[model samples]
Target: MATPLENGFSAPALRLHALDSEDLALLSAHVQDALVRVGDIAYLPAKRRFALVGSRFDWTAEMEGRLERCRAGLHFESVQRVRCARVSRDEPDAILELLAVTFEAGPEPPGGVIRLTFAGGAAICLDVECVEAQLCDIGPRWKTAARPTHELSSSESGAP
Candidate 1:
């Protein structure tokens, strides 16, 4: 129910809403990079919500800032409990595309868990606090940052 706000740049930034697990699943499908801090993650058992506040990378033009990040907060409602609530091997930041998040269905009353599958077979499980949830994007604004790039291999350029 949130509307877009003008930021004096490209079109206004709009608030995103995901009322269920399915919607939340799509957010991570092609998400390659995210600025995550260990302190940014939280689980409120009493409120049945798991939240993460961070910046996500987007592939956009330079005028808009390619490395420009989107500062947003994702709230996963109806969380029962979290299995592995710690970061991956003391890594403060992580690549989301290298990770997969799955939500499994459970008994009628208890609900299920949000499974976070990372590279090297590392996984974190979050037990749902209820049968349903609301995944919402409270903010979406572009931030200034350097774009990420990689050097090309000699084989591809036919120089070797």
Candidate 2:
């Protein structure tokens, strides 16, 4: 069994990489409900990369009785193109709540569309040559009082 750190933290700052669908799924779960600003998103075509920085809620810490958030950076490499739907680059200060990251395979192997879904139907799609992505915690964690919640629809919740 692994022991907690001297400060009683169970884990160090997160640094994760995804080279395949399964790995991306795990990374997605860790970043669920992260808050991102529109201006923080960038696509560097010269570098074939798309990146963003956000405040990621620490779900792991929540389970340990500490609701906290920390700065995190996520980037995708080998990006071929980028698209946005219901998201405006004009509103640089607009905040988005990240809901999920999902992949839809293209006709060619290892090439696919990686979708970053946000609340309010906003989404960003990255056409990539392959699944090469990284997510890293970039700053100190600070306590927050609120934890994200989802409301299931009536049918899904067994309500008639």
Candidate 3:
């Protein structure tokens, strides 16, 4: 329904054509006049610089750290268009946390993910083209509920 940027991240810098409401609300609450989130780090890949998102933002050694975390031999492919249910209470929140990190909305160690939560009393989990994460990267990040990510039909999931 609502988009990520439309909901809040509509700024000129980050082209958030679509935004999740929960993320928008969290960011909105934590934002300040200067726009430096206490712990949220943003890396401008083009400039090779890193800065906090909401206030007191500055170019720290953060971007370098983020760059280091990219998976070995990992190359950027097409972005995933995923949708899942919010089956478990914790699923949606977890998925959002991971998405934020991967999308440059949060810390870097949390990056590399593709997931969705289907919500309606019970939630289902769905993930497409994703990097190896979880177990190794653990925290409050959410996951799609009971439903495991459906694999792409041999054809659709592989290509752009």
lDDT of each: 0.53, 0.86, 0.24
TM-scores for candidates 1 onward, in order: 0.59, 0.88, 0.17
Candidate 3 deviant stretches above 4 angstroms: 1-43, 47-147, 157-160
Ten-residue stretch with the least lDDT total in model 1 = 151-160
Instruction: Give the residue spans of candidate 2 off by over 4 A.
Output: 1-11, 151-160
Error of 2 at 117 (Å): 0.4
Tens digits of per-residue lDDT for model 2, 37-91:
9999999999999999999998888888877788899999999999888778899
Tell me which of candidates 1 and 3 scores higher on TM-score. 1
Q: Deviation in angstroms for 152 in model 1? A: 20
By TM-score, how accurate is candidate 1? 0.59
Please identify model 1 stretches exceeding 4 Å from their true place: 1-11, 30-32, 59-65, 85-98, 107-110, 118-122, 129-160
lDDT by residue for model 3 (1-160), tens: 2112222321112212123334433332221112212134323344432323222111121232211011011112223333334323343223211212223222433332332211122211222232322211111111111221233233322211
Better candidate number, 2 or 3, judged by TM-score? 2
Candidate 1, residue 18: the lDDT equals 49
